[model samples]
Target: MAGHSPADGPGDGPGDNRGDDRGDGPRAACVLCGEPTEYPAEIAGSPLCPRCAWQQAQRSACSG
Candidate 1:
């Protein structure tokens, strides 16, 4: 309960943009599946496309 805050907890609120666009540029590949990706966003040191990012978000929400 100490580490779980309703507002700050994972997937409990709006998505965070702080670490979304940490890449150098656009056009990258998904780190999870290694597929073509644009608007490259760094997630766990891997680039992810919008579609893959959405899927990852959903997964994270469910797991958290």
Candidate 2:
């Protein structure tokens, strides 16, 4: 761990800017809140902010 850290992993690091095997090209904002999304809008099908996603997850969890 002298020259790198765990956060230096593929997706965690900044080396995914070239649309590599991970297929990460350019990211877009959340369609609902206009916040940055982890993946592109197209890939996600619909952009969702973390806050909104968490809320949605909570709702979904409660559905059971």
Candidate 3:
């Protein structure tokens, strides 16, 4: 078989969100809750709002 599968089409690699479509738009909402966030939507990775960020930190802290 080939190195890549047909299902794994172009731009399907990890962290490949195809950000070019955003085109420098306004700030992005939280990826989890869809609330307004302070980070730019064009950022490479997901951006979380204040509440979500705090919640995520708490989850991580307690996981260990």
Candidate 4:
């Protein structure tokens, strides 16, 4: 088992969401709910979580 899962750690406080990664890739918070995302917020450019990012992607008019 990973010794540093979010549930097992202290978690990123609201004021400290720097989208930094401890291990297993970079991490960022959801711009809407303040929840951690699978990818970094820098990519999203909006501090959005995976769920929100995916939702935004789906809502996009692009198909490629």
Candidate 5:
């Protein structure tokens, strides 16, 4: 017990407290929804809320 520490368990270490690992870069949440954004390179006007992005995709597919 004397050699134990909180960091030894899950969600207790420095890495666990830092949040998702999207590499060493700044992070921003979606504009429409409040979720973490990923694959920023593949997305356009990304960080868009899921609801808005889905609608945009639907419109694009329909027009094509």
Candidate 6:
């Protein structure tokens, strides 16, 4: 891409801060299942693990 930089590309490997500004920070616990999440400690609001987040998304998608 013309406007993109190397940092905009895929993460080279582990410990790479490609997705967000938070880099290798502490992971947060999921509020529903008490499982560790990818979310950083400074992230706003509650965090949900991948499983719980998927379930929650399903519920929201199927709800009337």
For all candidates, the clash counts are: 0, 0, 0, 1, 2, 0
- C-alpha displacement of 59 in model 3, angstroms? 0.7
How accurate locally, in lDDT, is each candidate? 0.65, 0.70, 0.77, 0.66, 0.64, 0.81
C-alpha TM-score for every candidate: 0.40, 0.46, 0.56, 0.38, 0.33, 0.60
lDDT ranking from best candidate downward: 6, 3, 2, 4, 1, 5
Over all chains combined, what TM-score does candidate 3 have? 0.56
Give me the displacement of residue 27 in model 6, in angstroms.
Answer: 0.8
**Over the stretch 1-64, how does candidate 1's per-residue lDDT look in tens digits?**
7787666745522355444443457456777777767655443467777788999899999995
Superposed by TM-score, candidate 1 places the C-alpha of residue 29 at a distance from the truth, in angstroms, of: 1.6
Better of 4 and 5 by TM-score: 4
Candidate 4 on 1-64: residue-level lDDT in tens?
6576565545565435553455555577777888877665456476776677778888884766
Candidate 3: misplaced stretches above 4 Å? 1-25
lDDT comparison, 3 vs 4, better candidate = 3
TM-score between model 1 and native: 0.40
Residue pairs that clash (backbone atoms under 3 angstroms), model 4: 30-49
Candidate 5 residue-wise lDDT, 1-64, digit = tens: 8988777766734466655555746456687666666634345664765667888799999996
Clashing pairs in 3: none
Per-residue lDDT of 1-64 in model 2, one digit per residue for the tens? 6989665666634555544332555667887888877776457478687888998899999999
| Residue pair clashes in candidate 1 | none
TM-score, candidate number 2? 0.46
Global fold similarity of model 4 (TM-score): 0.38
Predicted structure with the largest lDDT when compared to the true one: 6
